[model samples]
Target: MSSIIYTLPEGFTTGTDDTLIYFYTNDRPSEKNKVVFTKNMLCLLQNGIKVVHTANGKEIVTNEEVLMLASGSILMSEQTVANKYEAILIFFGNKTLSDFCAKRRLSFNEKSPSKSIFKVPQDSFLKNFCLSLKLLKEQGNSEMNEVKIQEVLNYISTTSPDIFNRFVGQALAGKSDIKIKQVVGLNLHNGLTTEELAFLCDMSVSTFKRHFAALYNMPPQKYFLQQKMDQAKLLLSLQKRPSEIYAELGYENLSAFSNEFKKHFGLSPKQFQTENGPGEKAFGLPEQQFFKDVPATL
Candidate 1:
């Protein structure tokens, strides 16, 4: 299980147990910031709207809606249409969910969805359930917090079996041996070291490399860098500023980003943007020779 605890800056209040709950409100609107979720996150939006960009697509979340983000990274930008941004959030680690499943005797036979973000369909039962948890917090019943967590899991299992199965599958996926495709695609935008990624995949460095090489027919490092470059080109064609996108591409500094771009595309980001028009392909998706051999999850 991941032990990374996300501690927000000052003015953010947190409640904790096996799961971490954050009550967040920001006076100022947020700029597009890169956020890495080390654990799966479920948020109930009480006010304002949040727009998130993942590798797959964009999601717009608003009040009365629930959003689930898989354990990975995303570029998030927020806007407050009327009031300040406020939300009740739970960050659930795999170990916690696995324990919950063990206690409930719940198991899933299906695979999780490949898309990183899921907008949970809301119902009256879910709304009342969330409200009851809110009341539990107001009443200072800290001892019942775990009960509330179980209630949420139980509600999901009964009302939305597909989502419940997906959650279960995700919980188990972290512990078992997953495919090379799942690990690489999910972490393409992540900046973890090779050793760190190997650890996350439950493999030794040597084993991870051997499997990765067998699948991609290339070194993992080189293959990932090429993928990042290709994604950068796509983002640039959409007129995103290099400064705004460099960090999301996992580059630490602008100079290095510029150097890498020039090396790959034969022009600086700005120059390329100025010279080449939009809708041109930088390259076509890194050969994709083994994609047919790999089936996407769900």
Candidate 2:
């Protein structure tokens, strides 16, 4: 079952369990920045982009988006983001999602919520699903995917992806004491230059260097390059947008993407994105890969 929670920064006021949390970051602009295209993320648009490098980023997705974490080895984020948002939300973790995928014939689209925003087309099942979240919350096992929860989640899979993503977001938000560290890659995944990293996070270069070593035992540039390369490989395998992959990983030019790709795997970004095998560009997707912690009870 899914229960909704609201996340707020310190000093923010809120209401009951049914209260909706505000998500927009004040500094995040609605401006359309340069878009990048690479291998997984090809058809989405992201908001709140602050480019630390060149003005023109990759042209990966086509619309402004709210990205969601879907799958993979990423365990950094506290919540998974999905593109193509909608009004309703549906979520079932680890077991529920896995079991349903195993038993049903469904394919999660690579598109963001901005694309189609799920469509339920029916309601008989919707009523039951809402009840499930409410009941779970009331019983305080809102995190668990009991047989009842699974039934509701799976039944609602036919509803809309938006509803599913919302449920997941809401459930995660509801938890008390969610640590900011739960977000995996704030500065970790995409390593930055000492100065660049310091600037983005609002710290001095000296402080940034010290913290970088304390966290990863290396300089920011090295960490950034490694993540850039790692993402390059995943972009190839997941078929994510080549250009966006470059920007997300901190590259400023196709040359940078190409050079890094070669340094890591002897292949250029273009060649890798075109490759149709694992460790190469296979499918493109948005939202940085991160493992949103799912309650063990679920």
Candidate 3:
């Protein structure tokens, strides 16, 4: 079997079964999308599992339900089939998790603080998440209640949402020079105003925007709001209070935050919490609201 290795830039844990993650394919066809799956599968990436499919004499990732496989390719997998191909991973076993970690080739120790990275063997994550997903199989969730699922999601969010926010923040903030070897990069604050940030970065306002744009798509001011919103979505998912989130975001007035959030996202921040709080799985809200701000060139 051909194995793919990834030097993960962020740490991740999934909150629920409805969430699917993509590491390398940002802004590509295979970028994040809502997927359909029959059997339960949680694709965790400790060792990078490359899903290849063959089409027109080449490997291609076919468009299928949750798992898409390219119809053509030659490889050593007992599970291989035509017209469909996908990667499976299992990390429950100690050896399995170790094998995945062996391939994390990036040196994250270059920074002041080291980020703790962990992964489930690919199949392990897939399976565990599926087992947690009672809704996917249409299984009666009369037994699965909010409090229990929230606890699982809370654990996943503790490790991942912050990491994802860090990635999006670092990219949006134009911090290419900073060696971001881990997901949450030392818990650095990303919400900085252009005026406030220029002073912090030791650059003049004009110079800051110019340098910042090179690394991030837009100027820092616009990007900061978007980044905060993304983080807020993740927070809301765990059933955090809107008033607290507003305070956590350092907004003096909750009403102002709510209005802008509603204008930008098509739903008030409070509405988002109600609609998608724990089990709605509405992952597309932020993208729809803030994608317009990304530089056209990006």
Candidate 4:
């Protein structure tokens, strides 16, 4: 499937660098769009059906529910209602959250389940709060936008303590290594650039490169290429024709796939398949067997 990368805050022209509040609207339907959220986000959907796909599972959101998302990569699809889709997005970083909690002396339930995303039922207070944000946006009062975001967080803390604790816990958890693994594993076949991957992992390109090398024992590009080549070989061993599997492996065409396969394995896909018949071992063991031992980080 084709994918689009959306890097928020930088993608929009509203609000400050660290924290932003914007009224988001769309006139059409969008599906499977990859969003790299650099900051924690609170989304109040006024109209539309939003399907969010993450490592945990799929979540369907609507006007009756609000979505609280931590900084990460997620596949999102939105279907418009009445020819329009609308939501108010508030983006803030961990520092903003920490400051809000410290200023209020808010204590989280450490035992609460940490989740990267949350869907909470919208209440009257939240609805009114969203209305206020829309008014402020129209008034060009950027200063109050941050306060309004904090106000929503405070409201959630008091009204929905369980969800607030879980959301906050995940936001401040700081599990960088686990996050790197998840981001890399999920987007391996999605044709994303290293810069985009770094953005998804919420790290600078330099930091991501360093961490990637430490974890994978190789450069990111080389590791990705190796993995893709391995997959191509596995597909070939399964009796799948080169033309049938090249697109599945993200190659632009059969020629590109064959060229890379030859460079990596010293044989074209057809030549490899002929040399090692279907269902026979190619790498001294069954290709399926190799996948069984693949580590979670992969």
Best by TM-score: 4
lDDT of 2 by residue, 17-90 (tens): 21122222233222332222110100112232321112222222212322222221111111113422212223
Clashing pairs in 4: none
Clash counts for the predictions, in order = 0, 62, 18, 0
Better of 1 and 2 by TM-score: 1
Candidate 2 versus truth, CA RMSD in Å, comes to 20.5
Worst 10 residues of 3 by lDDT: 63-72
TM-score of 2: 0.30
In model 3, which regions exceed 4 Å deviation? 1-176, 179-191, 280-298
Error of 4 at 231 (Å): 64
lDDT (Cα atoms) of all candidates against the true structure: 0.69, 0.40, 0.40, 0.81
Off by over 4 Å in 4: 14-16, 109-114, 175-298
Q: How far is candidate 4 from the true structure (C-alpha RMSD, Å)?
A: 20.9
Q: Which stretches of candidate 1 lie over 4 Å from their true place?
A: 1-17, 109-112, 177-298
Mind giving the per-residue lDDT tens digits that candidate 3 earns over 1-298?
A: 2353221111233333322233222221231222222211223222222343222232223222122211112231222233333333211221211111222322222222121112222144434654455353366553444343333333443445544233223222333233211211222234445676666656688876776676456776676677667767767766777887886765677897788788878998778878875644446444444445442211
Best by lDDT: 4
Model 2 regions lying over 4 Å from their true place: 1-184, 187-192, 199-203, 241-244, 273-298
